[model samples]
Every structure is written in C-alpha cells, then in structure tokens.
Target: MPTDHPAPSPRPRGWLSRFDTLRVKLFLAIAGANVVLVMTAYLIYSWSFDKGLVEYLNKADENRLQPMIVRLAEGYRQNGNWAWITEDRQRWQDLSREVLGTGRMPRRPGELAPTPPAQTPSDAQPHNPSPQAPPAGAPPSGPPAPNVPPTFTIDPRLLLLDPQRNLLAGPEGRTEQAVLKAIVVNEQVVGYLGYVPRLQMVASLERVFLAQQTRTFAAIALGMLAAVLLNAALIARWLSRRLRVLGDGTAAVAQGDYSVRLPTRGHDELAQLAEAFNHMATSLQAAQQARQQWIADIAHELRTPLATLRAEIEALQDGIRQPDTANLDSLAQEVSRLTRLVEDLRLLSLSDLGALDYRFAPLDLGRFVGHHLNDAASLSGTPLHVRTELEQGVEVRADGDRLDQVLNNLLQNTLRYSASPATLQVEVRRHDTEAQLTWEDTAPGVPPAALPRLTERLYRVDESRASASGGSGLGLAIAHAIIEGHGGRMQASASPLGGLRWDIWLPLNPEPANA
Candidate 1:
C-alpha cells in the first residue's frame, strides 16, 4: 500500500503582492516618503514656534504689571499712613480676585477672619495680630518701613519666582522660575513682587498652542497628500506617455510592420527596456524574413514531387505501367505523403484557433507512466529500459486521455529520432501545488535553431529527413496542445542523455469548473 498524501497548496498572496505592478509600487513609494518628510518638518516647526511665543508673552506681561506696583507704593509713602496702604491693598486684592479666578488662599487655623475691610491703619486697627508678628519685632505693618508700601498685589501672572526674589506680595506661596523682573523700593523691600505671565496666561497659551499645532499638523498632512498626488500625476503622465509610445509600437509590430523603434536616450530603466524592445523587434523582423523564405522553398519542393506523382498515376491508370506492385506502391506512397502534409496543415490551424478538448481527473502518476511504458516497449520492438523515479501515491488532477496522447507522441518522436537501444526515463515530482514530469531520450536532440519552433506544425529540423523517415511533423505540435488543454505546459530542451527532454508541468489542484 502507498501513502495517500495530498499535494501542498499554493501560498495566498498578501494585499501588497496584489499591487505587484511597477506603476503602483513606484507611486506608493513616492507617497510614503513624502508623508514622512512632511510630518517631520511640521513637528520641528511647532516645537520651536511654541517656545518662542511663550517667551514673548511672558516679557510683555511683566511690563504691564510694573506700573501698577509703583503707583501703590508711592501713595503709601507720601501719606506715611498704613490706612491708605490698607485701603489700597483691599482695592487691589479685590481687583485681582476678579481678574484671576477667586479661590481661598491657604491659611493657618483662625488666620482667615471676618474683620471689616481695613481703612486707615491708625483708625484703631489694633496694631498687628500676634499671629502676624513673627517674633522678629517686625516693624508695624503698613508702608514698608516708611518707604515701601505695607502690602501690594502683584499680577498673578508674576507668580513664577523664587520666594527670595519676590519683591511684592505675590498672591500666595506659589513660585516659578519664569518670573524675570522683581520690584524693589528704598533699601528695604516692602513686599515681594515679580511677573512671570505664564501663571496668568497659561490657559490662553495652551489654547493657542493646541490650535496652532492642530492647524500646522493638519495643513502639513493635507499639503503633503496634495504634493504626493501632484507628483504622482506628473510621474504618471510622463510614464503614460512613454507607455503609449511602447503600446503603439507593439500594435504596429502586431500588424506586421516590424520597423518600430522607441526613443531610448535616458539613464532610466524605461530607456533600457525600450532599447531592449527595439532589439527584439529587429530580431523578429529578421526571423520573419527567414521564415517566409523557408516556406517558399518548402512549397517548391512539395510541388515538384506532387506534380510528378499525379502525372505518373494518371498515366498508369490509362494502362501506361500495367498496375504492378512497384508502380501502385509508388502511387500509394505519394498519396500518403500528400495526406501527411494536409494533416500537418490542419494541426497548425487548430493550434492557432486555440481549440482543444480536455477531460480531467485525479490520476496515479506512477501507474500512468507504467501503462505508457508497456505500450511504447511493445510497439518499438527494441526492449526500452524504463526507469521510473517517482514519489509514491502522488496524484494529479489532469486529463488522462490527453496526457496519454502527449506521452505517446513524445515516445514516438523519441523512438523515431533518437539513437538505437534508447532508454525512456519518467520522473514525477511534487512541487508545491504543481506536478512536474520529465521524459528524456538517449539520442541527439534537435538543433538549437529548431528548439524554439519544435512545437510548430510542419516545422521539421530536417525537411529531407521528414520525407524519408515518414514524419508528419505535427506530432510534437499536437502533444503541446494536449498538455496546454489540461491546464499544463510542455517544453522541449536538451535531455540528460544528450537527447531531447520533454518536460510537462500540471497543477495538482484542478481549476474549478467554468473557471
């Protein structure tokens, strides 16, 4: 018993592989590079732009708050009274609370009070609360030791400063390093003050930054996409122009005008391909001329012999050469020759029409080869050494009858053309979802010049030998058709034994019906 393992399946292609065309690949590559470059530029611009904007806003804010602090200090000094300072402080604090959002300032227990707003410090405002006095015998609160204002409200935006650098009563204990200008009056500082606008303008700054970033990124993305599309369009236009030229050239060649040439003076791959195409056209034109000449020569050769045979037969029928075996045999032979030529012409016509029938089924390749080997050995009369090296139980979906025709033609060609005592080697191998079969002979293969046209009907390597050897020159052509009809391919090349090698490739997975 043999193993019944199925053949491997073909690998499924990914989405990327589906766009394997050169045009699609090139366009996608261009677009991808453009997107990466645009995104990188946008990120760099936004980072630097936001930093500079923040610095400028901070500086302008400090200038605006400077004057307000100086005015409060002057009124307290001129009056020499803490009452005016208290009144001023209350007014400023209230204004600040309205400007910057109001929230309870952090305080010790009992520090917050329900006391009426301070008026004149001398109006029995009861000196300083014991809790307010830091035991340093700090001067009575109000104007800063005669010159500095007792208390003053600085801009909340100026909150970014170290406590040691604060020259005005900063809202609370909050401090930041952005505070650039600190205020000082007389020798002693009345209260800490400085302006770092980030404290007050951060919300506005964040909103602006966000909006800028969004706009910048969005613009870059869209701009990049537009640039890519434009570039692709230009590239496509140029490529399309070149391709159109090539298409026109191909059409001309198809119409039998083989004098087509493409412009190929660039360092691009397209130029190289164009040059190569022109070379191919030149070669084909030369080959066509040779083919036309060969056909004329063959027609002349065929006509002379046919005319002579017909005349002799007519004369013989009229009792010219007594209808003997020699004369009748000669007549019969000529008819046979004419019949073979007509059959060859018919095979070529069918191949051109692409008409071939195929009936497919799962076949045991080893058994198929063995059966054919028996027939070939029996018919050839010479004991053919059949060598079969195949993976056991390998099955293929193919047309068995068509395959039999293909094998018979190949074997017949081998027995007729190959040297005596020839051996037939059949090998069946599984490769992915395809099965490859190779048949080799022990005689010299056809010449290299004839290799390409071996499957062409009536195309014999030696026309002289074709007549003498009784070859119709259509066997290999028919074989090629049968293999192709079964969704397979057949090719002839040099064999391992220095003879002809006919290799056939068939799909193990049968194509679906109607596919």
Candidate 2:
C-alpha cells in the first residue's frame, strides 16, 4: 500500500541567486572598482615611501660624515702625508670618535645604536668647571635650548680611502656602492671619506612609524570603500525599485489591465518612461472602451433591421398579414439598409488597412463640384434649393470615383436629413496650396458638444440626427477616412446657414509653370 505524502513546495532561492539582480550587480561593480582603485593607490604610496625613506637616510649619512671629512683634511695638512693614520689603527679610531663626538668605538654589524644628544658648552670645558655650568649629566635648568639639526648614527657603514680610492679604515669590500665625499685642504683634494648607501630602513622608530602609517592608511581606505558600497547599494536599490514598478505596470498591461498607471515622480529618464507608460495605458483603456461600444452599436443596428424583417415574415407565416406589394417593399427596404451598413463597414475597414484603391489624377475642383451639384439636384427625392459659389481652375490630385462617392454621400445626408425646401450652399475656392470646399445647409444644426466626434464610427446625435433618419452613422466616418487617405482632412462645425457645415481641404495640384 502506498503511503499518502504531501507535495513538496518550491525551494527558496539560494543566496547567490538572490544576489543576481541588477541591484546587486551594480553594487558589486562599484565595490570592485573601488577595491581596484584603493589597492593601486596603496601599492603606489608604499613604493614611493620606501624610495623616499632610502634617499632621506642616505642624505642624513652624508651630512653626519661632513665633520669627519674636515677632520681628515686637517690631519692630512698637519702630517703632509698619510703615514700617521695608515700605520696606526688606534689613531684612526680616535680621530673618528672625536670627529663624530660619540666617544664610542665603531659598532658591529646588526647592532643598533641610539643617536647621541647635542653637546652643551660645559661639556667642551670639562677640565675647568664654570659657576654657570649645570651639574654633570643633569637636565638643563633654564629656557629651552635652541632647536638643533637632527643627527644620525651611521658610523658602521663609514670607510676611509686615499687619493687612489683604496680603503684605509672601517669596513671592507663595499666600495662599489659607496658614496665618497672629498676631503679638501686649501682648495686641493687630499683624501676621501666614503660610506655605503643605505639600502633599506633600519631604525626601530622608522620601522614602527611606517607600520603604523600603513595600518592607518589601510583603515582609511577600508572606511572609504565601505562608504562607497553603502552609497552604491542605496542608489541601486532606488533604481531597481523604480524599474520593478515599471515592470509590474507593463505586466499588468500585457494581462489586459489597461487601467494600470505608473507613478511619474521626477524629470529623469525613468520618470519619463513612467509617464509614457501611463499615457499608453490611458489610450489602451479608451480604445478598449470604444471597442466595446462599437460592438454594442453594431449589434443594435443589425438587430433593428433584422427584427423588423423577422416580425413581418412571422406575421405573414401566421396568417396575421398578407404578402402584399407594400409589405414586400418594406422588407426590401430593411434588406437594403442592412446591405448598405455592411458595405460601409467594409469600406471603413479597407481604409483602415490602407487597401483602398485610389487612382489619383489632377481634376479641376470647380468643374468637379459643379458636375456633382447638377447630379445631386437632378436625383433629389425632395426639392432642395441649391446655390453654388464655384472658383474655376482650382485643381487638385484625387481619385474621381472616390471624390464622387464623397460628394454623393454628402448630398444624400443633406437630402435625407434636412427639412424639405431646405437651401444648400456649396462653395469651392483655392486657399494657399490647398483647394477648399465648404458645404452648408439651412436649419437643424448639430449640437456644439457633438461637433468634434462627428467623424467617429457609429456615432449619432440622439436628437435631429438619430437612427430613425434611416442613417447607418458610418457615412461621415467613412468619408473622413477616405479624405485622410488622400492626404486631406474633413471637419464639421456649426454652419452660418443654421445647419451642419462640412469643410474639406485637398492639396492643390502644382501648376505646370511652378512645377
């Protein structure tokens, strides 16, 4: 028998995966750059410090050996030869001790000797004690002594050489790297004082100071790096939060939540993106609402005609009405109305898809309007008083059949909707580079609020321009689309004649001379 077991839930993301987001990546990039920069600076500072310390110690050694050079020169002057120092090691030691003022023998290798203190005036006159002298080795009791130059203990590396550069005293076999100071007497070179150049820091205080400084610098670098990391993390988190909001908004829109809006807080690119997304969402919401309204309108329009036909046919089948000429004619009219609505919808779709076949050719606007006016007058079911103000030679590039269709639709609307014996005023003129046509009818003007949406598909005024006028409401919409496809525009407004006004603008064909 199988035991009942619960399903395993999803495993939580590992720490590494959790840090794989853009925020973490950005933080790491900033931290890595700071690390590289700090390490490079530390390495460069250490190298420079080491080089500068070696140079400083070498210079100090040269200064300390200066007094020794003078003493060696004075000895040479007195002796007039090197026999006194060369033959006697004890003489050389005494001369070096007296000149250096340390009163000590030369130190062996690896031995660290502290620098001797500066000499007081009393120390120079030890044989005769003065009344002003302080007790032996007691701290001075008076105003502080004047600042003295620093002295270094560098005797272990000291070497003496003759004019020929042969070592005479001190250490041996270090001549190659020794720095020699000339021992001169009366402007004539006699012998030389030399010492080996310092290769590394040897003083305990210097080594301790360098180590402390290194630790301090390392701590400062780490502090600065920590600050940079904190700043980077904050910035990354802020950016990531903003981006996540946008992502959520986009996802909502994808899921058909058109009402989703993002917060636009600043003038940055991210803020601009949020604003654009909000605008797009608003447009999508409006389009969605319009689409639903359009479907409802289409259904209502089709239902009215279908219901009329169905009711009449059912009456005849139930023997409640006979199939007479008037009854058949009523049914035919409903079918015709349905057919027209379908055709108008198809035309609008074609225009939307850019599939409308337009054969463009230059046609004289004046003559074209005059011909259509005559045709409309001859075919009018009710008497329409027509007036025309045609400007001759006003030409435009347009499709003749399409232009005729537009003109017929306009005339039909005027004849069907306008009161009988209504006066129709038509005007054609040239306005700059465009041919303008204005059609105005007398009385029954459209409402002010309904003027702008006159070209919207399936939209109708509920008062004088209602569906009872036997209009499919797609005529003006189709006309608007056709005009737009021809690179022109159509507009409606309150007419001066107290009816609806239609303004049509078509680009004028270039004159042959101007072309």
Candidate 3:
C-alpha cells in the first residue's frame, strides 16, 4: 500500500535577491541616468574650455614667434655659426626666467595648444624683441591701432641643428621629441629650429578651477547614489513588512481564528485592502458562531422528541400503557413534533441555498390579512377579543402561499408565546409604494434587543420555554425567510397592546419569482 503525503512548500528566497526587485532596479536606473547626465555635462564643459583656450593661445603665439623666427635666421646668416645669438646669454636667461613671472606656458605649433593667460604681468620684462621694438638710439615703437587684439609671448625651449645633425646653438643637448622648423637663407635649408615644449603647461593657480569642477561632479554622483539606495531600502522594507503582516493574519485565520485585525491608516489602496480584510474577518466570526448555535439547537430540538417517542414505545411494549387512542395520540404528537423539526430544517436549508420555490401573483392584502386573522381567532376554539383596523383596496404582488404561511407563523407565535386573554389587532394600509400589515397582540412581549435578532435562525428569547413548546427556534426565522423571498420586509417591534408587534411591508410592484 502506498502512503500519500502532502507536497512540501517552497522555501522563501534570500534577501540578496531583493536587488532584482522593481524598487531597487528603478532607483538604480534613475541614479544611473543622473550620473550619465553629470558626466556628459562635465565632458561638454571640458571640451569648450579646451577649444577656447586653444584659439586664444594660437593668437598669442603668432604675435610672439613671427619676429623671433626672422631674427634667428638673420643671426645664423651674419655670424655663419650662431655667434650673434650665443654671445647674448643674458637675453636667453631673461627669456626662460620670465616664464615663471606669469603662470602661462608656450605650446608647439600644430600640436597641443597652450593654456590662455590673463593680461601680460606687470613685472614682466621683454624677452625676444619684436622687429618693431627700437634698437639703440632708434625711434620707439608706435601704439597699436584700436580694435586690435593685444600682443602675445612665445617661449618655446629650442635647439638649432645643421644638416649633419651638429648642435649649433640652443640648450646644449639633444631633445628626444622636438618638432623641427627648417631655417632658410637664399631659399636653401641650413639649420633646423628644434623646439621642445615646457613641462605641465597649465598654471598652478588655474589648476584649482579644474580640480573644483571634478570634485563637484564626483560629489553629485555619490550623493545621488546614496539617496537612491536609501529610498530603495525604505520602499522594500515597507512592502515586505506589510506583506508579512498580511501573511501572518491569513495563517491565523486558517487556524480558525477570525478575530485578527490589521492597521488601516493612510489614504492608499493598501489601507482599503486592510479594511476589506477586517470586514471578511468579522463576517467569518459571525458565521462560525451561527454554525455552532445551529448545531447545538438542532441537537437539543431532536433529543426531546426522540426521547419522548422512545419512552412511549417502551411503555406500550411493556404493557404499562394500554394501546388506546389517547396514549396513541400522545405518541403521534411527539412524532409530529419530530417531523415538523425535520421539515423546518429542510425548508431552512433550501432558503439558505436560495433554492426555495415560489409562485407569485397579485393579491388583495386587506382581504388576505382579514381572512387570516378570522381563521386565527377561530383556531384556538376559545373565545377571545380581536380588534381590526384594516384599510380597504390594499393590494400587493407576492407569493400567496408563502405570505399565508408567514401570517400563520406570526399568529401561532402570538397564541403560544403571549398570555391568555390577549387582544390581537390586525391592520393593513399603504405606506409609500408598499402595503404595510401589522399584528399587535396583548402582554408578555419580546424584549427590545431580542426583537431585532428574533428572525436569526435558531435564536429564541426563552430557550427553555420554546423547547418545551416543541419549537425548534425556526418559526420566526422561517417566517422572515418567507417574507423576504416574496420581496418584502418583516420586523418585530413593541405593540400598543403591551405585546409583541409583527410588521410586514410588501412592495406593490414586487418582482416576479424566477421560473
């Protein structure tokens, strides 16, 4: 034989997988986009700076280099060796030393551009004299024309080399990677202008601007990352906590506890869900209580009649009671009580399942209640005072058989539950679009709270008395069901006769029953 076992449930996933969740993913997406935007903006700013700096540096270098190139060639031509340039060492020292006075550097033409400088520093002395500059006793240079861009300086570290690569004049060493400009006299190449650029050209003070911009961008990226992570954590924690609570509540309810309640704060969809859960819990609890009550009441109702029937049969078998009509009638009555209980239960089950059958038609309500009261007044075979205040021409659409049964149940209740010498009043009248009927009887009425719950199945104001009277506690409940099935309303209220009142309201144009 194979033994069956339930399948094991899957284990919960680990928290690290939370990174794959929508909240974390969305936050990271936004953060990544912000970082990309910041980087793009920084790149654009850097490009613009380089472009402007190159243009400015190009103009300045042109101003400084044009006259110097011609002078270098003239010196080489006259001395035939570089004696005119090398003999003047003090000017060479001034040229290199003034590089420090202003925080700017020279650039190789057609290569990396030099950084732009502010106006020429005041402490600056002339290095390479322009052709326009006055020689000894010569006329001083005239002021530049208006609307012209100011002049510039060039300070490229240079070497001169002949065709055989012989060092002629410049710093006395070979430059590893210097661009060469050919020096020409009589349109013939003689020596080369070997130019080496200065080291780390941008000024030290200007480095601060670049550094600050870099720091600002880095800070923004880090701050945005931190914010995204924090927001993701908060959102994930909130969703998981609420879901866990809901899971726990459901587990408790599954174990037959319906009293669990969840917090319903905030004006969000989650709060609405909490409210609906609470409502479901309350309904479940009420249903459980009703089921327990129905079981106990049914058991009690069956036991009394069964016990009576058994005792009677035992007495007849023992010959203690003769087989006469009176003793037989008692047994039949007990059997009748048991049968009534079973029938009532069957009808209730049918009504509860919405399977009860009905045949609907228009009826004169005033005449129906009048005839019902007269029949009730004569049923007891005892003379009793009955009052009537029935309005004529009161009509309604309903299931006539069901309505009759409801009225009969109410009349039986008055006879069984009320004190003797009670006066019963029947009335019918129109109230809005409905026809209202009332049965008010004399003393020993139901309590105020009991009246409201009287129509609940198996609910009885006096359980002991109801049980002794062979009531299964379903009379009023069945009557209420009948009335409701006919698309009408019924209620128990305080009567003017110092007794219970049964009020019925039936819509004049009630919907027909389903076929």
lDDT of each model, Cα atoms only? 0.66, 0.81, 0.70
Which has the better TM-score: candidate 2, or candidate 3?
2
Candidates' TM-scores?
A: 0.48, 0.73, 0.63
How high is the lDDT of residue 417 in model 2? 72
Ranking by lDDT: 2, 3, 1
Regions of candidate 2 where Cα sits further than 4 Å from its true position: 1-17, 37-206, 416-421, 431-433, 510-515
lDDT of 1 at 352: 63
TM-score of 1: 0.48
lDDT of 3 by residue, 387-485 (tens): 888888677877878888888788778777778786888889999889999889889987887888989887888877976565677889999998888
Question: Which residue segments of model 1 deviate by more than 4 Å?
Answer: 1-61, 76-256, 263-305, 313-333, 348-353, 362-397, 419-453, 487-515
Candidate scoring better on lDDT of 1 and 3 = 3
C-alpha lDDT of residue 72 in model 1: 40
lDDT of 1 by residue, 163-230 (tens): 25532444565455545543344654444445544533346446566687779677877877798778
Q: Native-vs-model 3 lDDT? A: 0.70
Scored by lDDT, the top model is 2
